[model samples]
Each structure stands twice: as C-alpha cells, then as structure tokens.
Target: MHRLELDGITKQYPAVRANDGVSLRVKPGEIHAVLGENGAGKSTLMKVIYGAVQPDAGTIRWNGSPVTVRSPAEARALGISMVYQHFSLFDTLTAAENVWLGLDKAMKLPEVTRRITEVAHTYGLDVDPQRPVHTLSVGERQRVEIVRALLTDPQLLILDEPTSVLTPQAVDKLFVTLRQLAERGTSILYISHKLDEIRSLCHHCTVLRGGKVTGEVDPTQESNASLSRLMIGAEPPQLQHGTRPAGDVVLAVKGLSLAREDQFGVDLKDIGFDVRAGEIVGVAGVSGNGQQELMAALSGEDTRSPAGSIRLFGRDIAHHGARKRRHEGLHFVPEERLGRGAVPTLSLAQNTLLTRTEAVSRAGWIPSGRVTALADTIIRRFNVKAGGPGAAAKSLSGGNLQKFIVGREIDADPKLLVVSQPTWGVDVGAAALIRGELLKLRDAGCALLVVSEELDELFEISDRLIVIAQGRVSPSIPVAEATIEKIGEWMSGLWAPRETA
Candidate 1:
C-alpha cells in the first residue's frame, strides 16, 4: 500500500487556481521530490497535505485508507509533520516553547528541551533550545524547525525548501539525517527548486507547472538540465559575470568589533573588508556566525561600532543610522524577507515606503498615486506575481515576495547595494533574473556586497569572495582563484593566517 496518495487535488483562489487536478503518490521509505517554479503550486499542495489549507477538490489516502485531515493537529495525529518554507514559529517564544506547542500537551517543557538537544546533536543541527525566535538568524531558525519536526517521529515528513538557508556543510548533514529517516520507513515529500539537490537526494520526482503535475521520473537517472526543463519548461538563462577593473572603494570596514546585543547573539570581532565600484563582494558563512552582526554594522542598523571602524568613500559613517546611509546612496535588502525586507500586513505599495521616499511630498505626505505607480513599475520590471499593488506582502508566495523585495531595492539604483540572500526560496528562473540584475548593477559601476550561504550563487556572481566564521572575517580571494573546497574550508574558519586588507 502507498504510504500517501492524492488524487485530483484542486484549490481555487480569487486571483489564481493554485492547484489544478494534481495527483501524487508516495511509498514508505521513499524520498519523493516535488519540483516547480515560484507560484507553481508546490507549497500550496504541501499545505493541503499538512492540513494547513483545505483543497477545494481532492481525495487523500493514507496507507490505503481514505481520511480527511481538517487541521494541523489532526495531521500530526495521523503522523504527518511539516516544516514550512516560512517558519510557523512565534517570535516571542523560545525554541523549546515553540516546539512544545506542536507536541503532546502531556509532555513537560523540560523534556521537550532535552529532546531538542538530542535531536540537534544527532543530526548535526546547531540549535539553542532557550533562544527566542527573534534572536535566531534565518539559518538558525531553520535548524529549530527541523529538530522540532524530527521529534514528532512521524511516518510522513513534508519539508518545504528546508535547505534554503543552510550552509553547504549543514546541507550535507541534513541529507544524511533524511536518508536515515527514509531507511527507517519514514516517507519524505521534499519541495525545492534546486535541481542538483533533487537529482542527488530524492528517489522519485514530480514536476509541477501551472498548478498541475507535468511529469514523474526517477530523479537518480536525471540530469540537472533535464530537471530544469521539467520544472520551468526551458533552461535558466546563463548569468554574465564578466569582470572589469574595480574603481575606488565604495564601502570599507576596519576593525569593526561589537559586543553582542543579547545573550544569544554572536559578537563581531575585528571584521574588515572592502567593496569597490564595478564589483561584487560575496560573503559566505554558516548561519549564526557573524553575518547577521556584520550586516547590521554595515547597513547602519547597529551604530555601536567604534569611530574610524567603518567608512564609505573615506567618510566616517560608523555612527550613521540606516536612513543617513540611504541618503548617501547605500541601500540594503535584509535576509529576513517578510518582517525586515517588507512588512507583512502592508500592501505592496505601502511596503515600498520602507526603503523608498520618492513618492513623499516635502511635508512628509505620501502620494498614493505615485507610490502605486512606483510599486507597479517594480512589479512589472521584476515580473513579480501578485494581486496588483494592493496585495498584502504576506499574501504572495515566498519566491514572489522575494522578487518584489529585491526589485524594490534594485529599482532605487543606489550606488552601493548590500543584499543578503538575494534569492532565498526563489525559483531557478527568478534566481537567474535577480543575479543578472545584480551583475548589471555591478557593470554600471555600482558596488554590491552580497551575503549568501549558497556557494554556487557566490561563484556565479561575485568578483571577490570572503568567508565569515565565529564572528571573524577571512582574507579576500578573487573569485577566479577560489574553489568550492577552499571556500568550504574557510567557512569553518580554517583559513591560513593572513592579514585582511
């Protein structure tokens, strides 16, 4: 009997038909992949399976028995556990407290905390049970979600973009854990746009396009190109990362040391780097290291750095706030999309005001018509899929929302752009689009500081690369001379002794 089966699942929304007559099947001990572009209905289908959303039409069978899973609690009772792309964690709650809410009420909080540690250690996931969700970085929060789901000991696990925020080393560790679970007869429904990962990790693959299944194949026998064709109907556009002589340094950090703001935060220690005009500088590291702290310091979110530590064009701007830096043509796209990059409840037009003020009058009154026009231009330019300018930021899919946030910043045409995880959770096509745009910006003599965990992305777009580990920055290396092996080693703070310029 199949471990799980779905037939003719159809979900209709006012703006789009998210799922249309989609059928899927999974066997026990199988690792099945669901492949699609952004808004291709992969996440929506997963939600239907997890009971987070009710399908307008579908028949679900569990172990040869038809059943209706009305809620997440009911899904968990039926041995189905899901780790969403956008985490379902509460910011005010500690890791253990959030995990405990999804588990049996009879279990004590201390017991849940202990189990979290055990699971984390066993799977090589670094998680702090006592850390509040607000204090955790995107990558660290990913670990907490994984550990929580593993504790459920479910028969079926639905992971949506689980490795999006993880470092290369962390991804390897997670694969081992998933393989072990599959061997123990747990079925996994993995949803990701990463073709290489699906080809290597999944046994079977289901490709989705336009809210329907396009093909099903044994992923082990498929190539990345074949998978891309299945998902997006064509190959992703190749990025042109041609290099030119760099101009004057646009952003320079020297001896940037800052104490952690909270007990759970990582302290920045003597971090230094330089980003020059007409170039892209990529920062690679494991999450929870100092990337968060470094970004805060550079973006002027934290003005606690010592004088002469940070300079833009040789000017002391270490004490400048985000707005002051923005006035000097420095714009940033934060790693956290919904809460930081864009507000959740605000319309797309309103969210534009977070980093833009061109539509505001001298009296500080925002002109709605101008704001909507700007938002519309960004949407059309970046090809963001949404319900026009009035759609709430949270209403769009993760990838679509990412495109909008990135588009919002790129539209500003800043002299220096600091973007963290520019294409996190986005589709292959969208990733290529965003990377190409960044390259265009670089070629136009705009300096860019890109922070991402994806080594492939860094190698594709960056001119120079640096690694961060344990709150310290490594010496810079040209992208032409950098190798995955060397960069991976550097990510662990294993670089040879050298002074960073």
Candidate 2:
C-alpha cells in the first residue's frame, strides 16, 4: 500500500483557485519532490495534506485507508508533520518551548530540551534550544523547525522550502539527515524551487503549474532544463553581467563596532567596506555571524556606531535614522519578508508607504489611487502572482512576497541599494529576473551591496566579494580571481597574511 495518496484535491479562494484537481501519491521510504513556480498551488496542496486547510473537494488515503484530517494536531496524530515555509513559531518562546507545544502533553519541558540537543547534534544542525525564536536568524530558526519535526518521527514528513535560507554546507548536512529518514521508511514530500536539488536528492518528482499537476517523473533521470520546463513552461532568462570600472566610493564604512543588542545576538566588530558607483559588492557569510548586526548598522536601523564611521557620498550618516538615510537615496530590502519587508496584515498597496513616499503629499496625506497604481506597476513589472494590490502581504506565497518587496525598493531608483537574500524562496525564473534587475541598476551607475548566503548567487553577480565571519570582515577579492574553495575557507574567518598586507 502507498504511504499517502490524494485524489482530485481542489481548493478555492476568493480571488484564485489555489489548487485544482491535483493528485499525488508517495510510497514507503520515498523522497518525493513537488516542483513549481510561485503561486503554482504547491503550497496549497501541501497545506491540504497537512490539514492546515481543508480541500473543497478531495479524498485522502493513508496506508490504503480513507482519512479525514481536520486540523494540524489531527494530522500530527496521524503521523503527518509539516515545516511551513513561513515559520509557525512564536517570537517570545524559546526553541525548546516552541517544540514542546507541538509534542504530546505527557512529555516534560526538560525532556524536550534534552531531546532537542540530541537530535541537533546527531544531525549536525546546530540549534540552541534556549534562545527565543525572535533572537534567531532566519537560517538558525530553520534549523529549530527541522529539529522539531525530526523529533516527531512521523511516517510522512513534509518540508516546504526548508533550505531556502541555509548555507550550502548546511544544505548538504540536511540532505544527509533526510536521506537517513527516508532509508528508515519515512516518506518525505519536499517542496523547493531549486531544480538541481530536486534532481539530485529526490526519487520522484511532481510538477505543478496554474494550480494543476502538469507531470510526474523520476527526478534522477531528468535534467535541470527538463525540470525547469516542466515547472515554468520555459527556461529562465539568462543574466547579462558586463565588466565595467567602478566609480568613486558611494558608501564608506570604517571602524564600525557595536555590542550585541541581546544575549543571543552577535556583535559587530570593526566592520568596514566600500560600495562604489557602478559596482556590485557581495557580502557572503553564514547566518548569525553578525550579518544582521552589520546590516542594521549600515541601514541606519541601529544608529549606535561612532561618528565618522559610516559615510555616504562623503557625508557622515552614522547616526541617521532609516527614514533620514532613505531620503538621501539609500534604499534597503530586508531579509525577513512578512514582518520587516512588508506588514503581514497590510494591503500590498498600503505597504508601499513603508518605503515609497511618492504617493503621499508633503502635508502627510496618502493618495489611495496613486498608491494602488504604483503597487500595480511593481506587480506587473516583477510578475508577482497575487490577488492584486488589495491582497494582504501575508496572503501571497513566500516567493511572490519576496518579489514584491525587492521590486518595491528597486523601483525607487536609489543611488545606493542594500539588499539581503534577494531571491531567498523565489523560483528560477524569478531569481533570474531579480538578478537581472540588480545588474541593470549597476550598469546605470547605482552602487549595490548584496548580502547573501548563496555563494552561487554572489559569484554570479558580484564584481568583488567579501566574507563576513565572527563579526569581522575579510579583505575583498575580485570575483574573477575568487573560487568556491577560497570563499569557503574565508567563511570560517581564515584570511591569509598577504591579503591583509
């Protein structure tokens, strides 16, 4: 008997039919991949299977028996566990506390904490159980979620964009853990936009498009091009990266040092770099190694740096606020999409006010029509799949929200742009789009500082690369002279004496 089966699953929303007559089957010890673009019904179908959302029409069978899972708790009771794309964790709760809530009541908190440590060590995921969810970086929080689900020992495990924020090394470790679980007879339903990952890690693949299943095949036998065609109906557009001499420095940071805001946070120590006009500089690092603190300092969120530390166009803006800095033409795209990038409950058009003030008059009155028109332009330009500008930021898929947030800042035409994880959860096509837009900005004499854990992305677009490790910055190297092996070494805080000289 198959481990899990779904037939004719259909879900309808006010503005879109999220899933339409979708069907899937997973066998014992199978690692099945669900491949699709943003808003292609992959997440909706997964939610239906995990009982977070009830399908309008469908029949679900578990081990040859028909079942009705009415809630997430019921799904867990039936051996189904899901790690959502947007985390379900509470900000105030510690990692162990959050994990304990999902487990049986009979288990004690201390026992849960101990098991968390054991599982984390065994899987090499490196999760700290006592830290609050709000204190963790995106990648660190991802580790906690994965550990919590692994502790359940469920028959069916569903992971949604699990490695979207993780480093390449961490991704390899996670794949090892997943392979072990599958070998032990756990059926895993994996969802990711990374074509290469699906082709290598998954046994079977199911492709979805326009809320319907388009094809199913053995992923090992398929090429990346074939999988991309199946998911988006075409190959992703190629990015054009031309060489150009960098102009005068637009952003100069020197002797930037700040203490940790909380006990769980990393301190920024003597962080310094320069972003020049017509050049793209990339910052590569592991999560929680002070990237957040550095970004906060650079973006004016944390104005604790000393005077003369941060200079924009030769003006000292070390103590400037976000709004003041933004007014000076420094735009930012934060990594946390729902909370920092856009308010979860705010309409897309209304969220534009967070960064773009053109729709508002000098007297502080917002024009609704202009705001909606601006948002519509971004949506159309970026190809964001949503229920129009009226939809709440939380209503769209993770990738779609990312596109909107990134597009919002890019549309502002800033002299300097600071973006973090530009394509964290986006599909290949959308990733290409965002990258191309960044390159275009560079070609237009705009300075760009991109911070990402994806080395491949950094290598592809950056003219010069710098590594951040343990709250310190490494010497910059031209991308043409850099290799993955050298970058990997620098990520561990190792820099040669010659480079320092």
Candidate 3:
C-alpha cells in the first residue's frame, strides 16, 4: 500500500496562491524529496499534509483511503509527524521534557528520559536528555526534534531544512539515521533547497515553483543542473572567491573574556581576533560553542567587557551600546531573523527604522518618504519578494527575510560588518547572492567577520579562520592551512593554542 499521498491540494493567502493543485505520493520505506526555491510553496504543501494549515481544496489519502486532517494532533494520531525548520521547543525545558510534551502516550518522566537516550544512541544522535534545550547546540536540539518524531513511530515522517545549522560531520550522522529509519518501513518526506543533498539522498524528487508543481523525477537519474532548472527555471549563479589583499585593521578583539550571565551560560575565555579592511575573517564551530556569546559581545548587545577589549579603528568601544556602535560605523546581522534581527509585527519599512535612522531622518525627525524609499531600494537590490515595503517582516519566506536582514545592514555602508550564519535557511540562489554581496563589500574595503557552522562556506570566503569551542576562540590561521579534519577536531574542543596558531 502507498504510505502517504496528497491529491489536488490547494491553498490561498491574501496576496498569493501558496499551493495550487499539488499532488505527491510516497511509497512505504522510501525517502522522497520536495525541492523548491524560496516562496515556492514547498513549505505550504508540507504544512497542509502535517495539518498545521488546512487546505482550501485537496484530498489526502493514507493507506489508499481518503481522510481529513483538521489539526496537528489529528495528524499525529494518524501516525504522521513533522520536524519544522524553525524549532518549537521551549528554551528552558530539558530535552526529555520537550519530547514528553509532544508525545500522546502517557509515560513517567524517567521513562521518557530513558527512551530519549536509547533512541538517540540507536540513531547516533548523541544528545543528553537531561541537558536543557537552551544549553544544547543547534545540532543537538535538532536531534531532540528527530528523537521526538521517532518516538511516535509515524508511518510518514516529514523533515524541513533539517541540516541547515549542522556541521558536515553532524549532517553525515543524520543521513545515516534517516536511512536507517527508511529501511525500517517508515516513509519519509524531505524538504530542502540543497539540490546536491536531495540528489544524493532521496529516491524521488518533486519540484515546486511559485505554488505549483514544476516537475517530478527520480533524483538518482538526474543531475543537479537539471534539477535546479526544474525548480527555479534557471541555474543558480556561481560564486567566485580569491585571495584578496588586506588593509589596516578595522575591528579587533583582544583578550576578551566574560563570565556566564546565566547559570548554564558558556563563559568566553581569552578570545582574540582581528578583521582588516578588505578582509573576511570566518569563525567556525558547532552552534552553542560560544557563537551566541561572541555575537552578542561583538554586536554590542552585551557590552560588559573590560576597557580596551573591543576596538574599532584603534579606538576602544567596549562600553558602547548597540546604537552607539552602529553610530560609530559598525553594522550587525544576527542569527535569528524573526525577532532579533528584524521585528516580525513591523512592516519592512518600519523595520528599517530599527537601525536606519540616519538613512531616513534628519535631526531627530523621521522622514516617512525616505524610509519607504530606503526599504524599496533594499528590496530591489536584494531581490526580496514581498508585498512592497508595507508587508510585514513575517510575511516573507525564510530566505527572503534573511536577504532583507542582511541587505539592511549592508546598505548602511558600515566600516565593519559582523554577521552570524548569514545564509542559514536560505536557498542556494539566495545564498550565492548574499555571499557575493559580502565579497563585494570586502573588496570595497569593508572589514567583515562571519561566524557560521558550515565549513565549506568559511573555506570558500574567508581570508583567515578561527575555531570557537566551549566558549574559547582558537588562534587565527590562513584559510589555506585550515583542514577539515583539524576544524572538526577543534569543534570537539581538542585543539591546543599552539596547534591552532
């Protein structure tokens, strides 16, 4: 029997038809990939299947019988579970507690913890069930979501952008886990914009573009170029990297250390780095290894460092606030887009007000026209898809939101730029465009610091690299000298200071 199927699915929003007559089928024990570009409606279709959103028109068939899925609880009861790209777990809860909350079957807290550990070990997920969700790395948190899904033993499993934050090694481990799940007769529906991953791991691929099905193919028989063409109607642009000449130091951090704010927080220890004008310095580590703390410190969100710790153009600014740093020609794009980087409830034009006062104001008076014009320029320059500047920040897709956030900072023309996970959850085309913009900025003499978990991205764009592990930063090395094995070892907190240097 077919494990899961959707026929003639359709959904509509105020501005667009999100999904139009979408149909898909997954056989038992098969890994099916849903491919699309940003705002292509892949997420909408999956949400319909998972009962997060009701379809305007459609039929869902499970085990060859038509059925109605009215809510997430209903879908879960029908042996379906989904792991979203954006996590839904509470930050303060333990992994076991989060998992227990999702489950329908009643069980003791100790029993739930035991099962979480057992399943994690069996699948090579390697998460500590007792660890608070806030304390776990991004990859470990993802494992908790996966383990929660596994506990349900769902007949159909759906995963959305599952590896965006994972390191290369973690991605491999996740693949093994998914393959094992598929072999055990659980049908899988995978959604991602990474064409290569889909081509390598999925048995069948369904392409979506602008809320419509573009094509379907056996991925094993298709090339990446062909799949890209099917999904986006064109090939993604290529990114070029070279050894750029460095200028004077623009941003420098020396002997920066901080005590943990929270009881479980990671205390930064002896972190030192420098970004020269016309240079890009990449800091790489698995998430939760002090990337958050470092970004906070660099962005002026946590300005409790000692005097002379952080310097901009040879001037100490350790006590400056975020607005003061921005006024001093420093710009930042944080990792979280929804609330931290951009406000969700605000319109795109209004969001620009968060940091673009100079661009849209004169002597403390807000110029409404200039604000709209600035937002319009950013939208056009970044190719952001939205309902003009009036659209709320939450209305855009993940990739589009990321583009807007990055573009907002880039347009400010700062002397120094600090960005974290610049392309997290973005599609390939958007990712390439964002990287191209960063390179252009670097060439234009803007110093840049990029903190990300993706090694390939760092190696491709960084002039120098550093590893952050357990709240400590390694000495910087040239990109040529940073090996994948060495970086992976550093991720585990194994590298000594001498080895890093």
Cα lDDT, all candidates:
0.92, 0.92, 0.87
Clashes of 2: 0
Off by over 4 Å in 2: none
lDDT of 2 at 210: 90
Q: What's the TM-score of each model vs. the native? A: 0.98, 0.97, 0.96
TM-score of 1: 0.98
TM-score head-to-head 1 vs 3, winner:
1
lDDT of 2 by residue, 2-94 (tens): 999999999999888999999999999999999999889988998899889999998999999999989999999999999988788999999
For this target, which candidate reaches the highest lDDT against the unseen true structure? Answer: 1
Q: Model 3 lDDT vs. the true structure? A: 0.87
lDDT of 1: 0.92
The residue-by-residue lDDT of candidate 3 on 1-501, one tens digit each, is: 788888899999999999999999999999999988899998888888888899999899998999899988899999999998777789899999999988865788899999988887776566778888887655567778988988889989999877766667778888987888899988999987777789888999988988988898999999888888897788878867767679999998999999877765689998888899999999988877788888888889999987899999999999899999999989999888888888999999999999888865456777888899999999999999999999999999988999999999999998999999898878778888999999989989999999887787888788899889889888888999889888887877878758754
lDDT of 2: 0.92
